[model samples]
Target: MRILIAPDKFKGTLTARQAGEAMAAGVREVFPDAAIEIVPVADGGEGTLEAALATGGEERTETVQGPLGEGVEARWVLTGKTAVIETAEASGLRYVRPRVQSALSAHSYGSGQLIKAALDAGAQEIICGVGGSAMTDAGSGALRALGLRVMNNDGARARLGGAALSTALRIDDSGLDPRLKDVQIRIAADVTNPLYGPDGAAQVFGAQKGADAAARSILDDGLRHWAELLHKTNGTDVQIPGAGAAGGFPASFLAFTTATLESGFDLVAELVQLEKALDGVDLLITGEGSMDEQSRFGKAPLAAADRANARRIGTVLAVGRSTLNLEDVTGHGVKALAAAVDCAPSVDEAIAEADRYLQQATVVALRNLDEG
Candidate 1:
């Protein structure tokens, strides 16, 4: 039998690659002779670097400004002429313990620094993974790091971070790095929120980033004003989908450079060449740390299952846990779900030994598939 084992990270435990290995090991116990292939996946967050590296990518690390302006080390993956950058590695919430005020002060300059490093390394294309950002500065800081300048009324350059956005009056992209003119930027974001207004970065995602009602209000106004400047200085439009992601990072990426926003999952799928991997494969197995309605919205497992279904291949999932029962997802792309918790003593136990439990659960799910 030919099998494809693909899975996302198990969060605190296994990485996407490790999860695939454990699931394959379990399958080997049941079908040692089974020809298996493993492809790890991510949706543009923490696991992205692993997924990229699994596909013959190289790693490069650099030290840059953290969200709160302290120095932090971050890394990116390079595959050929393409570089993959995980935004969270540089400007994520974990770098600065988030408070309602964290949103205002956190800057995404580190992400920009990474971009500069990638460009310096002769990367002609960049895939920026936009997730878990700590800033709400509309990615101005990132642009600044790339040679764009923002000046306030005093003709003095504005500071970086969300709080400083309120003072931005004009922008000067005349100093934008010339390499940026030739480089292609693909933003890996999965959401569709715009730059400002009710469903925008500040109003929808600010409170969670440490913004209260008043702070959210301030951030929203900041974003609006920033958008106007972006339009004036660069003729960039912010009404597009994904403009609000990473605290409006895409908004600036759009205004300041030539970029296209694509689903992180689709981008990952393309990177791994999933279509070719699925050729002649009999069955597919996939899962993540969690599974439910949210997975249907562009998560890797369901995305892979959808591809499997298209090819008439049976697919099974073994997730860390699930709030919805298997029946809830019946006929919804997955053939079945084997939750690790169901095979373990407790949820904590499942997460602690996620590799073992997920492997065990995959064993059961495969047995059931074989029986039926």
Candidate 2:
């Protein structure tokens, strides 16, 4: 039987491609002659660029500022004149140390630098993958790097950071680089948060960026102010769903550029032709770091399962962790839910032993495939 192996990255452990390879190895151990296909997936979050670049793209590197006010190096993928920038490369939370969680001081200037570099490289279009960001500056820093003037009432230019958002009095779009007007920007975000509200950028994602209760409130208010200014200056609304992704970066892109917001998974899936690969496949195996209620809403595993189900193919999920009620996943077309920690010493230990455990788990899971 033909089986499709598709899974998202296991977070701190293996990448999606590695997880697929490991699972494929296990599947082969059980059914030596089984036809298996590996498809790595991402939800427009971390590893998005890697997944996209896998389908053939030119790689380029640039030195840009990290989350904190520090010099760092990052990379982007370019396909012809279309460049893909993963926000995590410049403003990811992973850059923050436990002792230095300064959400206020982080910036997206490096992301802007990457975009600028792409433009300088003669790119006519840019695809920004917005995920795993550490700043909530409403993309002000990015705009700043593009030569937009974010100034205070006294006309002094504001520094590149989110903490200055609350103090900004004016945004000068006339000073924006002329090159930006000719470039098309597309934001690939996995979330659907609006610019401001309970489900808005700061309220929903700020805490993860190391914002405390006070910082959360401050960031929320700052985003609100920025959004209002954006609306006033651009004469267009900035609070559309998904506009709050990547710490309100999408809102800024919407306000400043002719950027279209799209689902990262859907875009990548179409690029990879996952649906075509799923056709005629006897069984589809998909997974992620964890499976839960959130998985139903455009996540990578769910996206794969949805396509497989459309073809009436059986789908099984093998996850590093499982939090969804069995009924929840079963009803969503997952024939079986397998976890790597079936008999591990502890959850932590299980995660540490994920690769080995997944191998053993897959053997048993596939052995029962024919029975079902």
Candidate 3:
């Protein structure tokens, strides 16, 4: 049997690579002579940089500002002149448990610092994976770090963060880093929310970052004003789909530079050459930390299964858990389903020793597939 084990991160427990390794071990147990190929996948979130590095790249680490201006060690990858960066490495929600007020103050300056570092390393193309952010500044903080000045009506520099963005009167890009003028920025994100509205950035995702109803209102209004400022400064429309990702992190890049948004799963899949990896594979196993109806829309695992279906290869899913039963996924080319939560004694135990539970679940899923 030829098996390809490709799984996304098991969120908060195992990384995509770790999950693949565990699944690979289970495959070895069930099909002792099976030819196993592991191609870890990511949907352009926490593990995006790791996925990029796995394919081929020179890893670089730099001390950059955190979401709340604290220093943090962030890592990125350079493949030729193209640099790959994940916003989570610098200004992710993992750095702080923000309250409504703190969420207003969180900024993405660290992400910009990473971009500067990439530029310093002779990068001309940047793949910015935007997600897991802890801010709602419309990427102004990042642009500020790149020398774009936000000013108040009184001709003074505006304060940083989302709350301050509400007072932004004008933008000064004269001092902005000229190097960015020649850079091509590709934002990898799975979201499709606009910059600001009921279905937009703050209103849709604010609560997850600690914004209350009132605070969400403030953040959404600020995003609206910031979008106007960007449109006035440049003829750029920052309210495009996926602009709301990572707290509107793509807005600044879209306004100030040549930036485009692409599907996170597609970008990562291409980066890892997932198509070539699926060639001639009999079974393609893919999954993530969770599975549900939402997983059908651009999530890595389903996307992988879709690819497998195209090649007439059978696919199985090994997830941390799932809201859907076996019947719910059979139509999506999933031949078998294995959830760690079902195999382990408890959900907590499954997460605590995710590698073990994942391995055991993969074995069962494979055995079940063989029988079917």
Candidate 4:
């Protein structure tokens, strides 16, 4: 039997590669003679850079400012004329501890610095993966770093960060780097929220940035204003689908750069030629940190499973946890589902024992694979 293993990162526990290895080990215990293929997947969020870099790319490192003005070293991945920039590398929430989560004060200037560096390096196309962001600045700081000035009514340049966005009155784009005009910018994003509304950026993502009720309202208002200005300056609408991604980074990029939004997993799958790997596979195993309703909406595992199902291949999902309704996934063609914590002392313990649980689960699952 040929088995394909493809899984996303298990959040705080294991990376997709590690999970695939563990799952492969379990399958080997059940069927020692079976052929297995492991393909690690990412959802264009936190692990995007790692996934892209794994496919062999030229990596460049630079020192840039962090979300809260701290200096930090970050890296970008380049493959031929295409440059990959992960926003999380510069302004990710991981840089801020729980106690220091401050959406109002956080900025995406460092991400802009990386973009400038990529453009300066003569990249013909740039892929900006927006995920794990810590700010709600609507990409204002990023634009500033790229030489677009945001000024208040008094004509002074606006300060960096989301809080200063409420005071922005005029946007000056005269100083935008000339090279950026010729570059194609693609935004790899997973979310589909618009720029402003109930499902907008601040309402859907601000709480994670440490925005309380008042802050949420403030950020929402600021984003609305930013969107209005962008709509006026650029002829394109800023309230399109996925405009709220990366705290409205997509909207900003759509307005300023030659940008288009695409599903991150789909992009990765095409890049890695996952469909080609599905040929002749008897059973396919895929997973993520959690399996839920959202998983159906272009998550990495779903993408892999879909490709495998197209070939009439059986697919099983082994996840850290399964919050999805079984019926919901049944119609979509997943053959089996398994969760890592079979019998754990506690949630913490379950997380700590994820690899062992996955291995054991895979062994048991394969035993019943042909039975059911």
The digit string of per-residue lDDT tens for model 1 on 249-317 reads 988878767888899899888888888999999999999998877887888888888889888998998
Q: Write the per-residue lDDT of candidate 4 for residues 1-372, one digit (tens) a residue.
A: 898887888988988888989999988887899899887777777776666666677889989999999998898988878888888899888888622247777889999999999988888988888988998888888878898988887899887877677788988888988787899988888988997778988888988888887787888888888888887776668888888888888777788877889998887775556777788889898888788888889888887877877888878877777787445676556877767765455667769888888787676556656567
Q: How close is every model to the real structure, measured as TM-score?
A: 0.97, 0.94, 0.98, 0.94
Which candidate would rank higher by TM-score, 3 or 4? 3
The lDDT for every candidate, in the order shown, is 0.87, 0.81, 0.90, 0.81
Cα TM-score of candidate 4? 0.94
The local lDDT score (0 to 100) that residue 17 gets in candidate 4 is: 80
* Candidate of highest lDDT: 3
Q: What's each prediction's clash count?
A: 1, 0, 0, 0
RMSD of each: 1.3, 1.9, 1.1, 1.9
- Report how far off residue 126 is in candidate 3 (Å): 0.8
Query: Candidate 1 lDDT (Cα, whole model)?
Result: 0.87
Considering summed lDDT, which 10 consecutive residues are worst modelled in model 2?
97-106
As a whole number from 0 to 100, the lDDT of residue 336 in candidate 2 is 73
TM-score of 1: 0.97
Candidate 2: clashing pairs of residues: none
Residue pairs that clash (backbone atoms under 3 angstroms), model 1: 100-210
The residue-by-residue lDDT of candidate 2 on 187-252, one tens digit each, is 888898998789998889888877887887888898888888887887879988998898898887
- TM-score of candidate 2 against the unseen true structure: 0.94
